[model samples]
Target: MQERTFQLLGLLGFILSGMFFTAAGIKSGDLLTLGGSLVWILACLIWLIPVLRDKDQER
Candidate 1:
């Protein structure tokens, strides 16, 4: 259950960060914000991997 929670949070973070990056990029054209968004996306993917692997193993 805790793992599931982390997965959900990661997904939520991924989505929110994407939106934030888009908005900030459009408004400010900042490289730092763009890079930060990429990092957030990578982190979310990393966080989700274990859950995805477990699900695959169940099949």
Candidate 2:
């Protein structure tokens, strides 16, 4: 349960940070900011995969 919460937190952070990065990119037109957002998005997906698997396993 703790691990699941951590995973959820990670996902939330990634999404929120990604939005921040996207906003920064839109304001400044920075490639680095966009890249960072992409990285965070990938991390969120990675974290989500395990959670999905765990749910299936539980069922």
Whole-model lDDT for model 2 versus the true structure? 0.82
Minimal lDDT window, size 10, model 2 = 1-10
The best candidate in terms of lDDT: 2
Local lDDT at 22 for model 2? 81
Q: What are the per-residue Cα lDDT tens digits for candidate 2 across 1-59?
A: 68778778878887888888888887898988888887887877887897879967987
Error of 2 at 19 (Å): 1.6
Candidate 2 residue runs with Cα over 4 Å from true position: none
Instruction: Candidate 1: give the clashing pairs.
Output: none
Backbone atom clashes (below 3 Å) for every candidate: 0, 0
Per-model TM-score versus the true fold:
0.61, 0.71
- RMSD (CA, Å), each prediction: 2.6, 1.9
Model 2 quality (TM-score)? 0.71
